[model samples]
Target: MFAMLRYAPLLAIPAFSSVAWAPPMIRMVLLMAVAWLTVIAAPSLTPMPYWSDGGGLLLACSSELLIGMTFGLAIMLPQAGIGMAASVADMQAGLSAASLLDPGGQHEPETLLGSLLLLAAVVLFFTLNLHVQLFHLMAESLRVLPLGAVGLRLDPEAFMAMVGSSFLLGLMVVAPLMIGLFAVDLAVAYATRSMPQANVYFLALPLKIAAALLLLAATLAYVPALIERVFQDALARLPSVFGA
Candidate 1:
């Protein structure tokens, strides 16, 4: 149980993503396997044996939950950035009306281009072995956030800054593509001035999509770099989440 608390930051990752890729039963088995490995790997990671005291145990659990959530949120920020950038691209390309139904998670609707970008980012996440790095980070966090410590100090301004930086990273990734699409819109707008009978929006949609698709193809070479830049920034700021 203590090990599980330590590993709780990773809990959201699988919950959000792996559930879509792996079956629930498989995920459970894998989770149990991971929990066992974590316990075996760090047998000395237990909190005080005095945790049997109800109130103390509650405090410890609450602290762990809060801290774990903070760390998990830090790690997930890059994924959020990807979603933001994709949404911008989709909206710019006039594809916001078209959505893909997520097969997992209650069949929620997701923007088509956004889903594609997210899927690519997830693939790159594993390809870059970030999962392994995440484990290393989790283990390292145990040092600063040892169990049974019930105190938390958070810097609101630092957190707000991190959020802003995350969005900026997203914008960096899609800026070129968006700029091209904006140019397309400008060109279409000027050309449509002569043809008053044209359905400007309807006609512009396909042109923007084609331009977006082309820009995306050109943009693909940079996605690995995008993931690298965003995650690097996010991970570097992880220790701050504990609040200096």
Candidate 2:
């Protein structure tokens, strides 16, 4: 138990760097500590196995780690896809020129709008206590899908269906911004077509930026609701993802 507790911090390294307000090493250790506590307390709250001895223990631990990672990625994939899609849209909107290097990943040209949206999502997660809820859901997952049951039988069709649905959910979350941008684009195109010599290049740039900003501001009110729905759907489908 002591040894397992000591090793708990290793699991948190990934999460530490993704958020702000901590040095890499410290955050890593802190995150690991959190994971350790959760895992240690998990079996008591749920019907999970405590540590076992022998070679099979290694296999069990590895399988648990893998399952945890898979579930984490499953939750994160939609957010990553949305961020990428928003970045692409920002690029097309001429906002790529204002890109900044994201510290979370190497050589990634992060867009201002996308970053804002991502930050907003994170804030909403915490403000609504979704993070705690996620942790609780994860804890319950151990009961539903134990260590040895990590890579359980999953239907490929259902797995694919879930992935497809997740993508659509991500798209819907960003749909409002996309629609606003599309409308702006169409209006700009019509104006340019009507008057090609009106220096639309210079005029349209600021207009589009302003319009995008306005849309983002207006849509801000809906972000918490959208994020809640996305998270709820993701959590609901987690058991299916694990083949339970």
Candidate 3:
């Protein structure tokens, strides 16, 4: 029970993060699958025998939950890079105003490119077998951070670095599109100045969108490799985050 409880958040984050765009039924199924996986692993995991007292046990569980969530969050952030890049690209392309509710969560509206990039990230996440690596990391964390001792070693610096790197990766992925859009903007500006009567705003929207799409398609081949590299970096940083 403790082991399952400890890993529940770790399992939940990746499972849900990867499939956030999926239907509720699909998310529920993945979650259930993770639950079973955790349960199966629980028997082999070491239990915290020192936390015999109620207060100590409660604290230990709390620590475990926090640690698991941290680990999961580190793993999940790289997948978000694609969405961030898309958001910036959409804004540049004038598609920011045209939005759709993100299927993964109800809170935010996503642009078309943003949605596609998000889906791509999720697909890449699975294709690269990062989920398997995540599970392996969770199991190994037991050796680094034994139960009851987890909460003390939380590394805020490492977490912040993880987040910063994810954003940087996102920017790298979309930099080409952004630069192309900027060039388009420059062309539109030059045209508008050359012909004062022309409505550049009207012409710019479709042109920018077209350029963004073309650039995106052109760069699509490299996205998986970028995602894989960023995700692997995140995974490599986990031990430091846990103070291992």
Best by lDDT: 3
In terms of TM-score, the best-performing candidate is 1
Candidate 3 residue-wise lDDT, 154-200, digit = tens = 78898888889888887888888999999999999899999999888
Sorted on TM-score, highest at the top, how do the candidates line up? 1, 3, 2
Regions of candidate 3 where Cα sits further than 4 Å from its true position: 13-17, 20-50, 100-107, 148-152
TM-score of each: 0.85, 0.76, 0.83
Give the runs in model 1 whose Cα sits over 4 Å from its true position. Answer: 12-20, 43-50, 100-107
Model 2 worst lDDT run, 10 consecutive residues: 1-10
Better of 1 and 2 by lDDT: 1
Q: What is the C-alpha lDDT of each candidate?
A: 0.73, 0.64, 0.75
Model 1: residue 228 alpha-carbon error in angstroms: 1.7
- Candidate 2, after superposition: displacement of residue 30 in Å? 4.0
lDDT measured at residue 203 in model 2 versus the true structure, 0 to 100? 88
Clashing pairs in 3: 20-104
Q: Give the alpha carbon lDDT tens digit for every residue of 1-244 in model 1.
A: 6556655545524643323466657655665777688666653655576587898888787787676666666656777887888898898897876654334545565776778877877787778887678778766766666656666677777777778888889788888888999899888888789787888889788889889999989988988898777877876776786686
lDDT, candidate 2, residue 148?
50
Tens digits of per-residue lDDT for model 2, 29-64: 666666677667756533235335566556566766
